[model samples]
Target: MNVEGRTIEEDAVSAPPPDLSEWALHAFCLGARSSPHPVVAMDDNGRILYYAVGGIDMDRLMELGLKPNESQLALMKAYRLLTVEDGRLTTSFPVVGPQVMGELRRDIRAISADVTQSIRRDSEEMCAELARRGHAHHGYAVVFGHAVDGLVWEQLRDQLPSTKLSLERPFWNGAFWAIHPRRDDAAGVNEHPWSEGTLVSVWSARIAFELRSFLTESAVGRLTHNADGVLPVIHSDDSDELHRHGKLIAERLAEAILCDPRSKALSERIVGTHPGESLLIFAHELIWDLMDCLVEATPLVRPRALDNGSAPASDLRQLLFIRQ
Candidate 1:
């Protein structure tokens, strides 16, 4: 967790060996969004049980090169610079473990409000679009871990008076809610997961939302009860070497974004000037927190078991558990 990172200056002299830990962390965070194929976490039975969720089609967009519009270009550049490879596994070890949790926990706690606001913007836009179609008046979900509760929502509602909050569930572990603009006529709480928060408020709201979307929306897979979480093996051979080269390339690009004046200017144009460097740093931090959260969650066996079984078994459970 505390591995020494290659300095930006070192990047200029010569590329260093791939930091497998760093690469794994990046893959854990951004694999779904950036890769063409599914990025899965493996269970003890060698079954791929968890799939990452992604909003954009990076490979398709990346292929557009200079053909995309300005906004698309900016987003593509950000994705290219920030994420590792799409379909490949980058580390030799399972990302989940107690040995690395301390570092991850600290990183999670440091997520910022700016990042939360950015994430909220995306969710709100989606909700607004849904409303336009008359599909639903409003939809709300929160991104949170087991340790967080509705208090976070309460505080956020207090802060953003434009939005109203109503709890659909009273439980602390996974509180669901319905939220919308105070002036909007949306009503009723329904089954959904649009709320967002992080444990100890350590992870940013944006990353938390992204992770929540992945866990709830993607194909459901179970974590093996006994194994340390396993990362998918996309390639039996040359994966480690490919990862090293990829890591080197990614680091150099990140460094160039910070160091080269031309690259810096391009980033400013793409990302805007208000918070500037702070915003970029926040993005970086959010990605790291995301990786940490994914790894931490992948080994838990209980969440994997919650999927409603196939139709026949679904009714059987109701019949078995309830008296006539």
Candidate 2:
């Protein structure tokens, strides 16, 4: 009996025969690779279709709530319309019938709907906060995001009361609103540049704290009176603390850019301005040198460009490097 069973199993386990057309085998191979977890292809009419289960362990099938017999049943159901070709089951036929295909598509669409709603909620909240801040500061708001999210927010922006959305600087404390999507859009980031917009206008509630902490730890009494009132000015001689302060500022700046959905674009811009591997170090050095020029001057000056080989004025220049 054992010898007979072994013969039967061996008979069942054969490579897809050559007589089957190339396209049929190709379709089966494609279905095997693309389907989810257990990889059971179904037909359009919800019929069970072909499955490649040759080497799959019995335990693995059990994990998917299948027994050896059930797995065979499911596969047979999927391939119910199959006709033998040259002593082999034809594989080129689609595993999924029309009915099952429609169900799977519907399921995917339902999932997409839920995700869209969640992202819309997040975008709305960010915009609402920007509108509130703009109203309080008597300024307009700037909304940005991945290309798709930006469009969605723009559509929703007009609904915001007393809010004007502009890509250019409107000479007000512009509230920065970024729409975060469920998935990171890498291509969009590489395409856009943050410097193209009024990056100087990015107003974060955390900026005040970051500025004070940088001043207290690095500059101490190096504070000077400027149009922005008493603020940390200029770089002293190179020291560990100054480097650390620069790193801190760079990290914060990086976070602001990355969180804004145009992080890759801004990174490209920063690289254009100060080309280097370690952006944190570049930002640190840049901040240190720029501040030195500002703080060391007898009378305060708003630097339009760096004496060193750095790019001309930017919001980062206006907000962090220079005193208000």
Candidate 3:
């Protein structure tokens, strides 16, 4: 038999393709160099991504279980989508494996359905905890205490003209009752303890163990805070831990926003911060980040504005350093 020499029938000795892991990683890294958005590389593991926040709502602080030596960088996710064009790379969100991604996606769907109820439970607990402290804190983007809501892509772009995201209003938080998967479609949850919401607020929310960045920064001064139209989304290493304390904080904040008075006055602020549209953008960017981490292949990717047939969908998106 030619087995030892690696020869067999026409299709019998079809050895598997060379393990593309190394080259894949290299090519992907190079291609992804163009953009900085985290990506989800490809994986046979069936990873999952659960988007919790989008638009302008708070932050994207995902607690990957807690680590002691950790700085803010420890908790941040690195998943992102990649594109290679004209010998260059670009990125989307961060990346995750298929299993993780699937689990998160399903988990989020399940959570979203009963978000209002979940938030209420969280609120009660948060209030009790805050009471124990004798004083409560607040946030800035208080829409009746809803905390945060995403503006339309155009509106958000207008508000924060210096930011970039592959999709429209890409934010997710565990506190975000809006996008948490409602159905039983979620496959699993990670031991790391995932938090959902916009990446902005949470990334820098943690400052100290006893004292966190969220309580100090995102929290409104209640009667003392008053700002309109513009929302603050500052990024820093601290974002990764914003959810470590627990999802209860997010729930409490969301509930407060939904029922607050000063926030109710936001009739003409955001234009149209709907549900379905924003979620799609959130999911797309998140998923792309996952793929970015898992898969590795270089196809003459290119950068361009808008998704056009000009050079294939993926290539066009990767190269888009600027879009009108």
Report the C-alpha lDDT of model 3 over 1-324, residue by residue, as the tens digit. 121122223352343112112111211111122322222223311111222111111122123222222221222232222222342222223222222334454444333334434333333333344335332221211111121122112222322223233343233211111111121211110011113223222110111121222223343232113233123221212232212112343434334334443323321122223332233323332222222221122111112211222333222212111000
Tens-digit per-residue lDDT, 139-195, candidate 2 = 111111121212232332332222222333122111111111111111010111122
Most TM-score-accurate candidate: 1
TM-score-sorted candidate list, best first? 1, 3, 2
Q: Higher TM-score: candidate 1 or 3?
A: 1
> What is the lDDT for 139 in model 1?
21
> Could you tell me the lDDT of residue 2 within candidate 3?
22
| Model 1 poorest ten-residue lDDT run | 44-53
Candidate 2 vs candidate 3: which has greater lDDT?
A: 2
lDDT of 1 at 136: 26
Clashes of each: 14, 21, 96
lDDT of each: 0.25, 0.26, 0.24
lDDT, residue 222, candidate 3:
21
- Model 3 lowest lDDT segment of ten: 185-194
Off by over 4 Å in 3: 1-82, 85-113, 138-324
Model 1: per-residue Cα lDDT over 220-311, one tens digit each = 23211102322111111224332232233233333333444543333333221233332233233333343234224322111211222222
